[model samples]
Target: MRKLIGCGLVVALAGMLACGVGTEDGPGLQLAFARQPLDAPCPELPGEPGSAPVLDAVELTLLRADGTVHFRKRVSPGSDGKVRVGGIAAGEDLTLEVRGLVSGQVAWYGSAAPVNIRQGVDTTVGIFLAAVGDVSCAARPLQAPRAFLAAAGLPGGRVLLAGGVDRLQADGCGPGCDAWQATAAVDMYDPATGIIYPVARLHTPRALASATLMPDGRVLVVGGVRQLGLQAGSGMFLQVAPGDVLASFEVYLPGPDVWIEKTMPQGMVLHSASLLPDGRVLLAGGGTAPDEEHASNFAYLYDPGLGSAGEVVKVTSAMATRRLGHAAVVTAAGKVLLIGGAIYPTAPPLEEFTPSAEGGVFLEKLSSGLPANLMFAGAAIIPLRPDEVFVAGGRVYDGQVLQPPVTGNSRLIRRISSDDAEWQEGPALASPRWLAGMVTAGRELVLAGGFGDEQLTPSREIEVFDPQGELAAAGQTSVERAGHAAVPLVGGQVLLAGGLGPQDVLRSAELFTPAALAGESEQ
Candidate 1:
């Protein structure tokens, strides 16, 4: 009996030894980092000594599926200019983020594709870092201090910018004291040359307007605030007096470089305009009066084929709710989905507008609303798929002091049928954002700079959201911005232009070439 007991004890000791050995031999990930040869010139600060940026440091972070940081390490490159990070656990899928810094500034930043660790083996991975794309200043617009300006991409890779405040005086007023008058100045941006040339100005000066590209290649510029006479003692430009919303509309012809004045039934501001499948523009829900406090429930349809005079038609049925700063998108089935707006108390319900048999429009309210109360969120339809739409980064008022809370609850909603739709919680953005520029490039959704709750400051971080995967950090702009314009270029790249930047209104613009295409160009 003593020998038997000793044998059991020996076996137990052996089992424990085996477990210890297994842990020591557990799988790990081996990462090797090398800087990719850049085809473009490295970025340099003006009057700086260095001709090209040099790598100073690299930050490595391993994130779990939920975007929580699991392990973080900072390392410098070896003599061979390579970094190796090991000891990652096996069998767990992880996202690897590598940020390269030059003189403490982010020079190159990217994420490695998700990696799967294998037990008992060292998984080897190679990461190549490239220089951040070159950002050269484009020609400034003819008019200075352009704010709340409208821009639309033309068919031939050109962008039309129009109607914003141009400072007229600069005394003891303030930052924008000089610019009190909205200008009708129009400018055309040529991407090939990185220059903007003045074009014909609009008949009426407007600001905070909506510009939509028409089916015939003309651009339709709709309602905005036309400034009344500036108050004598006031240092700032008064956008409008009471009941001073401009009902005038205009169509810009690229061929002639001209703006033809048109008229709308009602003056609107902060309204959303979407192009329908039938080649008509759906203008809906804006502030009827100049003040944002008074929102309109009215909707209008502008028929471009009918020519300039009396082309806008008012929809007989009014919207279920008055919306200001709302978003609208046309679905795959030719229905319009009107999303969250400035309405308060409870989250605004999702409403769909369907075309009726009698050449009218029908409005139906959907039971499934937004995940939360959202306003000024950047929204866009996922490319190639009409049924699914992506909405991200908006402000939600929680009945307290105004805070820019990053809900981290953005989502993707699909229209299963005319009335049936489903919502799935999407990957959270890297940071909370509102009033950002959203556009689709290839299969990825690109969200650019926006205002965040962190100090109420604008974010320069650009996050790319893959519908099938997680949000990956992407290239950033030269300046922090919100209320900017992001227009997808002919290629997969995006043209991002003017908006409110860190200090004041900006006329700067940059081109965001997708990393894949950017890689190809380097090769």
Candidate 2:
């Protein structure tokens, strides 16, 4: 498989961009786009392989803060590229959109957000344009290969990735193999430039933890182990000592780019963390305290804004059942739903959380018409609509020993009203994917990057959850990936960053441009 190249404008040196030609000049700002070798097969430019496109143009559109178009121009580009765009009113909240055109069709996209333009001043910003509906390699590789890392969306169109193990245990270590002394290494991925920047390391290194984006833009990472290992072949646990089982969590501040550790009465692993509408983080169901590797029904609400000390209050009522690897998501109506999850492949009734001024209540929803023993333990539960979530590929064991039970089956969970919700059957994927990265692109869900085999072999196909409850083939990520971080970027592109391949943890990243973002150009 070929690694799709990441093509975009890089803001290095703040000088000449040869691909795009600017039209007019006034009191606006000056910008340039850096170019990369066009490696992908373009039907329009069949003759140009390594040569730059001098005849191709870029459609530039300036947008007001209210999302209204302020200016639109398609400049006939020249080989010596540098565009000087201007002619805008002062104090206008402006944004610039650039679409690289090949044979009069939009092929690449990038954008810049800003606070208007002024005469004799240069506003420097970076923009990244990725090919639509394709997965390509990042311009740069990750610092190292890592798995079980925590990724949270940060301010300024950046993603914070922290605390993951860099090694892969090829020898059989069984259950204890999942936990290892994690690396404190931290990094930031910028969609604007398609670059991964190494940042401040975590004060308390942890793996298998959940990173939540706080309302204030800070990151609150909870649970997971500080150090754990096992003997190869013997399957004996080791490195279990003081601080090995983390009894604390870390908060990462973006401006300072530092990690601060906070003490907790007990730590947890395999926990489900969800941010509520009121700025409180709802942490539910994981192995906690001395035993941080088992399932517990306890839940808590972590308030990051309360005092400087902050506060972690336990929910009075516990979950209906013990869920180790359960999936949890906050509905559009601000309700929390705990879906099927267990240590193994087992299906459980969905649980909903309703908060009052006094406390939050957890009620188990009856599996009235669900498949008998429907398993979504390793599946992805993502937002489909307001108060609705759709479940995608996961480990669905159906007792067929001859055939692997990993399934492509999917279902939609719709919160019909405040008091009731229904499970609607969704279309099955062409390929079965376990632990797939499912993210919403506009109204559609892009299911990409997962292991399709029982041996944890990665997959490369990209599927879409169409709005009409139908499944359609969108495109491919080209690179095999499992357990990677799939995140939506500023523009309409999805970033699939690092995951485990066949034998080792991967350091390669891929960028996916959604079909909806390209409009009619895809057809």
Off by over 4 Å in 1: 1-143, 168-180, 227-242, 288-293, 308-310, 356-359, 397-403, 407-409, 416-418, 454-456, 519-523
lDDT of 2 by residue, 270-377 (tens): 678888898888888765221324557788888887656366778898787666445677666677878765433343557778876555988877554553223323
lDDT per model vs. reference: 0.61, 0.63
Clashing pairs in 2: 4-136, 4-137, 18-81
lDDT of 1: 0.61
Instruction: Give the clash total for candidate 1.
Output: 4
Candidate 2 global lDDT: 0.63
Q: Largest TM-score belongs to which candidate?
A: 2
TM-score of each: 0.67, 0.83
